[model samples]
Target: MNFRQKNVLLILLACFPFGLIAQAQKKKSKVVTDPVFSAFSYKGNDAIYTDNPLKADEFYNPILQGCYPDPSITKKGNDYYLVNSSFSMFPGVPIFHSNDLVNWKQIGHVLDRRSQLKVDSAGISAGIYAPDIKYNPGNETFYMITTQIASGIGNMVVKTKDPLKGWSDPKKLNFDGIDPSIFFDDNGKAYITHNDAPDRGKTLYNGHRVIKIWEYDLQNDQVIPGTDKIIVDGGVDITQKPIWIEGPHLYKKNGKYYLMCAEGGTGGWHSEVIFVSDSPTGPFKPAPSNPILTQRHFPKDRKDKVDWAGHADLVEGPDGKYYGVFLGIRPNNQDRVNAGRETFMLPVDWSGEFPVFENGLIPMRPKLKVPKGTERKWEQGGYFQNGNFTFNEDFSKDTLDFRWIGVRGPREEFIAKTKDGLIIKPSERNIKSNKVTSTLFHRQQHNAFEAAFTLKYAPRSATDMAGLVCYQSERFNYVFGITRKGTEDFLVLAKTNKGETTVVASVKIDTGKPVRLQVVANHDEYRFNYSTDGTNFQNLGGTVSGDVLSTNVAGGFTGSLIGLYATTGNDIQPQ
Candidate 1:
């Protein structure tokens, strides 16, 4: 009896362990099958299509649309390269290439690596500001100088032989200024110009700034000490008490050295003023017709309005015609701007010794002549003809297109491209957080447009949610997502203004099927809707205020963006 009992006990012990292993395997499989997932595919409406065909003799203003402001253009051989300021969004300093200057295409970003930039804790519109791109034909290299304001790096310069591939590591310059620019002279010497606080003393007035110059030693990769000199104090006219004499660019044309700068700040008083000097540094005289380019003189009651036109850089076109690229904003009647400052182009007419921007104060002419022999494909030339169009993203491709941008630096772990669709994991940081969040978005290219995406998401806890957002900054944004309250799930629309979040609308929903969330932007108002099925959508509740997302209310230098985001709100992992 004892031998039989011992053998039976051994069998039971081995079988009991096997039974437990089998149960654990079954639990793991359940977790894998019921994993938290969400899918989104979007397409815009193209009903209000404009039939303005691209003409060989004429082109449109805003050669590059959207939030591409503070442009710095440089020419290499027959090819021209341009870059714009990218504030807080990572992959900063988006570079574009163009042959005709009218039709342009994005080459890549200068600061593509997280090591090359530091914007993790940067506030909105605080990362990179007013980058100036230049090509040194003597050295056969390209240099880009910019200010990383939020990173507290002052002005940094990055150079490369091939800008399309990538740029070199940033060399933090020992300069105390913003909007730093580099000018290469005919003598192989390099000069850097920027705007800094006058004399570095105590505060005088709000906008008391000066344009200073320094001799930069390229071989040493630093500015020579004691070479720092104030070139223009208090802008073109010290009596006017001009402010923000920044974005300084130096050029030598027809035996005259011209120093151009953006004056009167970046608001309604913005303007471009120029001065001529015999040498790169020194007794520069302001042009009689000062403020060569500005929209300040244009009446507010004009039929068409474009304000804040300044921060200009001049480039000679392929046909030897000079053109200026500058930043301008179009504000609604409420003085709220949602599109942010965009890059605009105007013809430059030489007046004796200085350049005068044509069409001064009047609305920019929509039609202009392209350079002769300038040829472009149909798809590349008509970027601005139709103000709006449908953008369908299926996420079937292996990599995201260049139009997509991530906040701060992109966290690769938060995004996964699956065969079915894109899979995004919720980060601890949400859109409203000042810290960098895991969100990928595109610019709100149009003021009046619709954005919708279908997502299959199931939040396990009240802290987990995934959906769409129209983000302006950490302090101001709108979110529409499928959120959980206890065990129940609801589709919610919320707005965050000045760090205060308020739920605008919410509707209880079944978690059994996918949800389609849509946002329709009509001027300064936005309407949010959701649907179980793709065709029929039910409006959540009231209209969300879009003005709060504007630059006037949000107080940033960047435009709003539409994106898909997920946030866990805490460090807890999804079930």
Candidate 2:
């Protein structure tokens, strides 16, 4: 009885081990075969087709998307670098890099340090204005010239070894004017050009439409006196007409220095013109084909409808496509003003050795050769819902994809996580403050979108509050949060826009230990729902009212953002 039974039981136990091993292999094979595991690939190996013939699906072109104004692009070999106006937004000069012009990814901000730029207290449009980017062939370095909009007369220069990292401390050029550009000549001379008055010390006598260029001594790092000359003066030219001239970029090609300047205004009616001369200090003649690009007069179907275009820069792609990155705005077509100005790229066309553009057709298409792979692209809006954030029970380290950004700018202090959950720390100030400290937030870039989040918050102080936010700018943002005020819990709704954020709703937080907050936004309307328990939700209210701040209002050249944010307004000490 003992020997036979023992042998049979041992065989059965051994069979169980082999069976478990086979089942484990089958489970692994299933995961490898799953569409979500493979289709959610980042390699972009899969190819899919879009109705967009213009290749608009790649790299979130309109990369600067809405109103990311005064774009400056510098190309270094196959790598392209970009920077934009962070006006009033902290962490100025947000820099990005793209190997393929169509697929851009932000590496890190160049002006993360406070010494780099100063935007005092996010007031009405006062900060880094119109940055111009250039590369030197001799030294193989990149440089940026930026204006302090509120400060008036001084412009700063910051250089970088890598465009992704922090830039050198700005070497202040005490020269008075705005829209400054540095032209690096083949002869190894650096020249600075900016808006200068024709008649100095005289108020009405000075023509505002004139732009002057002068040989600058970069070795000494100063604007040279008397070396300056008026390159383009609108007071003289009549038939070859242009209204406002600013944001100049100088590049020499084929024995002529091309002076490219943005005209009209940044408003929806923006335009750009190019002039050529044999010298950097030019008694320049307008390009045989003047006004190389202008969106002020797009076709009936092409009109952006909102004002402001043309703060542009020319970057030669790795494939040698001469591309112009410029900013334009598309109205939400809603009664409320959509303040976002969309950025567009059109190839610079050379007609008879001069740049020519197809009438009002600023090419809004991607130029990169589609990578040789299966084309699979994800839509910005969800297939089932329209929100910025998505969450699930599957909380792996991999659940957080690349779709998150910190408010004002990104910082290590703003984010943290464990295997269990994600946590965001409250920054001391609101978006309007100079501290660049806002509850860390990411953009809600879609017109119709939904954002959802699942989190547990443990606040040490009554002022501690963390939740999801749909923010257009400092003044125009709405947040849904569970805050601790004394022993009482305060559910808050803060509505801000047009330099004012009125607390529209504040109610007693239900006492059952508030843990999770979910806010869903569709178009301009927002709905707030909360859950003390993960399954059940309470509708707080949609009575909160504010304009969906776009490029038009937030005052930056960026789109609206919806992301996780935590705030402790004025409760903590300044940085």
Candidate 3:
């Protein structure tokens, strides 16, 4: 203890004030200089979940995995609410909760903050699309309706009498188009149905959409004014020119007023028809079993293949059976698609007058049966699987675990967990910026997974860069980190197709020690590795070509977003 008595006891413990808040959290934990990661590790090996396993009576066809597509469901008594499609990411819409509908549980994000999702500058496929959770019970309330195309907020609504406690912020809903949905009838009346076009200019083909409805006014929740009504037109059969007749969903069961919808145009000719109606405005009708769900007549090399199925919704299960919730696609070995667009679930016989999907039109078996007593022992955590699982994330908690998201902005702006880990903070825009920076994503759920992280960066220049990203938008992706090329410190890898990038590989590391950065996919290849004693690891690029993380070659309806990137505008380099 000499050294002038340790500098007079560190200047007498920096003159109190809790030592100046412990010297500003030790200078905000060195804003990440080296040894940076905060631990991450995903697993899911998917070979049809190791060639078909789970069987305590089965269950697992993408109970929410990867891009979590356009699914929407509702139920109140035995409580089961679900929703998906978070287009420009950034907490757009992801809401789940179940009571044995097969165990789901992610109770948050109904357009979480930022004035209810503005989608920064949009374009990661352009902000939220197709989200529609409902449950009116004549006012027991809970409506989500969505379409937020960014900034101008197109088609909206958000309520909650309770969704595990959270919601209500956006209300916009004057409507324009793109999957709306809201129907609550039984003398309490209330409607809103969506997906438009067909009247204006009376157009006919080229995906001529239609399906209108309107007369909502649930005590001024909008939509009244003109009574709207157009019900089903371009769908079920616009003379077979039916193109993108978007996701609709309207129901009333027994007394009839069905509606459903979602025809072709979501890729590979998607579908899910149905339409009938005695009221709720619609001469509806059109169900000679019309696409009661479709994998477009199968044969895309079938074998654990589940293609662009549909955009369904339909609930009733607490053993009363019914259930639907759609949006499929799991392609690889080059049929394309990269873990984007998931969330399945079947069972929907409805005795006879319409409502099929019980193993809907064949070729979709990823396994499912367990309905006996609702989830009869879904193996402990009550099941929430993606087959071969293992997630492991620990940014020193206290929050940030809605499965870690962020894209067009707001992840508390640029993250900051601490006690030494999740601090990210790079953002000066990068990841090909369409606005929001400081990446973070997570949703590439599996098509063969591996993921890994355990950082401690040290970029400092080459316009700084931080690692891992397999994203499929903001112009296709795949980066692999560590920057600075001048005074050394490399580790690149690049590869962005539609936005033009190409650095194949690089090395020269030692970014101040702790590093890990993996990736691994394998359904059509994609490698990229690194390590610095976290047990040897090496492989900088090698495999490649998960077809720019497919969505039929990244055209987008999303799927495959594996971020955790950082920036300062790094332009990427290596080659």
Candidate 4:
């Protein structure tokens, strides 16, 4: 060996010792110099549940509330499984289980592992789209199909024998589309359908899209090459000019293939349409009762309004009857979509050949009569869905609740579980960054709700801060927390609208014990409150407009998220 090569090898050997110092550096980053939050709590107080109490035979409209949208369901004997689109939330599709279809319990997410959900660098609305979960009785296995718009993983599917345990890693399908679903025919054949652009090059109108179907190979877990066909082009009637005809699910009823899809875009003009075909892939005909479900035709100023209804999935209930689960929204009094699209359930009337969503064509009522033989246990409070309810998280358990979620990364990267509560090790990334931050979020479930967190922290640097965040997106949100300026600590409330952040209120604070930060929203108004003592709370920001947090102003696909946040990139200054 040359003399210079020997010297270079010796230098490399001297630094090759990955010992105690290197292990410590690998455990925690040197730049992450933020505080750890001791404990956190959240509550919901909507007046709708109190004013209109549930009768002995009545329940709520939305089976699952908050930002849970794009619902798809499948039945396995008596047990039923449901899933929803999570967008960029760390754990992708949120799954639920129900026996009678009335009282549903969350079973956790399908893509829980980071390797399966590669959205670490994706935006809040760019990660996971509509997820469809179906149980193939032919193979006795469950499949979850979705579109990961990030990481070049276009459409994918995962499988599990039992959902309560966990799910498998995703298998990438050779297709380019957004929302994909699987159908298993009675004759032991499978097909995959999704929303895609019009066939290559064609004269397209505004929002012109098509639904394509592909023969799926069960053993290979992939779409057969050259077996693709466009099933529905343009929508109900091509002459009428339909838009965004996506989220398609195929079902066979009475020896006929029924293809149902969401027509129009996902916003105000959304509607559910049905089609009939003798074969799985063929010239499908739109039902005369075409818009089986919609709320766009109703007056905008209706009472207890639930608008933006579409993107539906149907499953037969336990009682020999049909039911459909779809996504809809309840705009606030100011006609703002702050809570995002929620999961609503309605019985489907299939007395005729084709199934129709009952009460889906008319104005959506707040409550529905409980069907016969279905248990009425969901009427009780404390569960977060159906009517108004209260939910709290102590973070005492080792495993976090399914409701609390991170945006682009795993919660374990910046969290430590203790007997006291959850410990959030602050990250350099703030709430406004596209990167993953030290924040655990819960969806703002109601228009009128209260969210608070008790945190004991000390900021050693001016950039260190830890408290509560009411998040709509990275560009539109409000941060209420304790930050440091020079040598003094202050409680500050800040708002970020369309990427510009400004401090709305600030006050000096000095507390050795734990301090509580709270935010209350009454329709369009929001208030930030703080408490040094456990009992008494003082309002710092009087009443701020919630216009920025609304979809009408924010122009995003997600709802507002209330989070326990800690960050070193604290921008809001103390005044």
Candidate 5:
């Protein structure tokens, strides 16, 4: 090696240990009881789950993480089981298991059956809506009810033998509902409650503005027809409100049933309300302290116009503490919203027969608390999706985590696992799945991070190519690849979003040799580079802004993903 090259390697290695030290020290950046707001703009930033330890723990109220909306949880012994809305994301209804209500891990999904809904090629926000997860020990089956919103339809139920696998086929309830929740009576009879969307039938006031609850007969396995009754009618409060009341979950405390739901539009900062009922079917009334949880309570986010925080589910913690989980948004910019709508948690307090909500914002820094005999693996993917799982050794699971999702519905031909690593076969498909063969990928979480993968290419023709990409949309993103021209190898960086390209270098190398590739993606920007000798590095001068993956502009049910791809070229077809 040249003297200059050797010196550069020494400097890079010498600086590596310092980076690790900084990370260790920065872990506690937010340790205050009430964190003072930092004067930083929210624009172009990634999701923030941890309170800046340096700032204090002021914003740590909501314990659960990610985009877990409309949480429904049940207590079994000391263990807490939770599930939430998966929308169009496949393997829907993520099931989470926790002991303390603070620390939770995903177990599996509930809607594993095809009868519940067809998801093979479903569009964004098309599949399952909010779902309520409940357990019936008498029948020893877990029940789930979700609305398939794409078809403008409502309510389907499924049961499972074990928490991890083998769920029964969907049993359609055939109601024009949006959110369906289940409540098990002490007498062992189960009841169903939902927001009724009345058929307008040529009237201005058509959709059901009322929340209904009724006796559900499992023997008949359907809503007890005609036994349905209105528990809470919005009356004047929800008039002209299109977002309306949805995501109803029932929790009986003392002698009252607390029907907690999300109201107002799902966007902006003006959402949320909690009500109570003396009987399962009531003259349900709003808690005197209504709108129990709202972003209005978070002084900092309120000043900037952050919108929407509702759709709550309640569960008694192992310590006999009451807690609630809901959906909330943290906007990236004041003018535009991106991938927001995250799962949040808070303590639930009861005053007399009513529930009280204080500390409107989430806890500044949240920590997970588990049971004595519990294992971490079981709680990892139980309710929704779990992201930020690290794999230093070989990947340890047969199935993927709820954290892993694709840009579009992935086909069997686009992805496979070879002996060396995961093989992503490319197709003519655009990143948006417009064509159907783009092999983009992402880990399911709201954290800013990066990942690296190794690859080997065997191109048959000059046009054949293989490489890695940071994918937000086929119309918007960047890619770095190794393409063969005749017998020559070239390093190219292409910005798909802007339609720009800049080739870094070229070398005459054997096509049969393996190439190690790496992608360093900032939650704010992306940098890609490749290594030929496995020691020297070559920088590809291209980086795409992370905002390209934002949910607002991209128009999808998920955030951006990182993946590898192989596409057709000159005339080569390896397979």
Candidate 6:
């Protein structure tokens, strides 16, 4: 069964235990608690520095690092705006603004409100798919279109006048496919392109997808019927039966319509192809040199090869140069996909009819020259800065940082920041639960790093618990928390793999004082430690393998996240 179908079955099974009469009368209690926020302390050695300090000409690859995938960029005058898919994380669709395209700062999220994002039933990688951002000069508004698979809100668009402030509510559209994109012609006509399932009797093989387009009627705010057409079926060569031709984007240049898309799925064979057409909906011709961008041909034994390079979007730099931003994976030890897919930037040369990446399809370089006259400036908020540094968050501010995110839509009352530290009210939804919970987490940017937190919470019962967690998903994760059993409090170390929970170790601790929990991750192994005085820590459990928490092993599209969480157990009956 599909994810939505399985979710329905799970919901039915969840309600099957209670009888009809009990279920009819049962009402869940409104658990209200102070908002729980966290302060992060980061220390790392892998800092990026430019080669030419005077000119600031060179910059590092993966410009917006760490699980930022399926990038869509649009240039508005001198400022460039970009957005990426969030996929089950709250505050979806992070919007970034940049002047030189080398340095980007996250301005805000397009879907920050609970009403805009409702992915409680969405799996780790099944919530928000590829998002496309565009700005309409005619209307003077920014538009973002994406598909929320779990919520069944197919092809929705959200707009805003000022991206720094907030975005408007989602305007659901009637589109039949995923990865929806908008293209505005110079004649003031708008078109929507997406990847749709193969038509009946047209599929010679499984996974045969087509790129379709339809004219969007902004007047009525709907896709106009009878304007639907298939621009590229399968791929450039339909006889070869290319698989998964998706992420279609239309660009108009020099009186020609350019349709760019990714082909051959999102795996190692992923690649970018281009097509040109005289009309927005027509018999487009593929570029002579197809698969213009990819790393699939790189030698597997190459030390610094990047895999899964596709789903690219183009933007013009400050110096009138074109640049491409695409998704690529930097595998860890044993070829494990731990960091998830990251955003990589490459210079685009456009002297030819069709634009091509400067480096062709080879592995992206570690360092490249930035656009001329590009200056580096450190701005506040969640903007990434290269070079060895530390990020210390005390949660003294009223708002959470852009780097911090929760699963699905966390309840507002479940999180708060106070003088004593961040307070999180225990919820019935534990880490193992697929639903939303009071768990605030940030991505694990480095393989070798330490995440330590001081959680000060007194458990009233055995059910109330709070601690630090290295979470991959509901199925695979490790939790180190302080909980009470009877009148005694203990520091607990637990692991949940494939839906089975096992308590590895538990140590009786004094509940009179606060607890400090730490998890040190070195490549593949993680060690858990705890302390009462916050000066010294004692190891509580044996080393845990980080492989089980990887995307390849855990079967998710997200990277590992280290964060603070609180749970009241699942046995709490409805009020």
C-alpha lDDT of all candidate models, in order: 0.79, 0.59, 0.81, 0.87, 0.57, 0.80
Task: Give lDDT for model 5.
Answer: 0.57
- Residue runs of model 4 more than 4 Å from their true location after superposition: 1-39, 379-384
Query: Candidate 5 residues 4-110, lDDT tens each?
Result: 99999999999999988888778644321110111111111233433222122133333444455667777767777888776655456778777666556777677
Pairs of colliding residues, candidate 6: 35-415, 35-416, 36-415, 36-416, 48-387
Model 4 lDDT-worst window of ten: 30-39
Model 3, residue 393: C-alpha shift (Å)? 27
For each candidate, C-alpha RMSD in Å? 3.4, 13.7, 20.1, 6.8, 15.3, 11.4
Per-candidate TM equals 0.92, 0.74, 0.37, 0.93, 0.74, 0.89
Estimate the lDDT of model 3: 0.81
Q: Compared with the true structure, what per-residue lDDT tens digits does model 1 show for residues 194-276?
A: 98888857446788888889999999779999999999888877776778889999999876789999999898899998999
Instruction: List model 3 lDDT by residue over 374-445, tens digit each.
Output: 653445653455578887887876887787788877788777777868877787778877988888888888
Best by lDDT: 4
Count backbone overlaps in model 6: 5
Estimate candidate 4's alpha-carbon lDDT, on a 0 to 1 scale.
Answer: 0.87
For candidate 6, write residues 77-151 as lDDT tens digits.
Answer: 888899988998887888888978877888767888888988987777878899999988878778899998776
Candidate 4 lDDT over residue span 1-575, tens digit each: 99999999998888778565697787754444344454455566677778788888788878888899999999888898899998889878888888888877787889999879998888888888999898998889999999998999889999999999899888999999778999999999999999999977874897899999999999999999999999999999999888999999999988899999999898999999999999999789999978999999998888889998999999888878888999999888899999999999899999997788899988998887777787677646423366666666777776878888999998778888766667888888899999898898889889998877778877766688898888888999999888888888898999898999999989989846778888889999999998888679999979998888898999868888888999888777888
As a whole number from 0 to 100, the lDDT of residue 404 in candidate 4 is 81
Where's the lowest-lDDT run of ten residues in candidate 2? 33-42
Give a tens-digit lDDT track for model 2, residues 487-510.
666667666666565666666756
- Candidate 6's error at 195, in angstroms? 0.1
Clash pairs for candidate 4: none
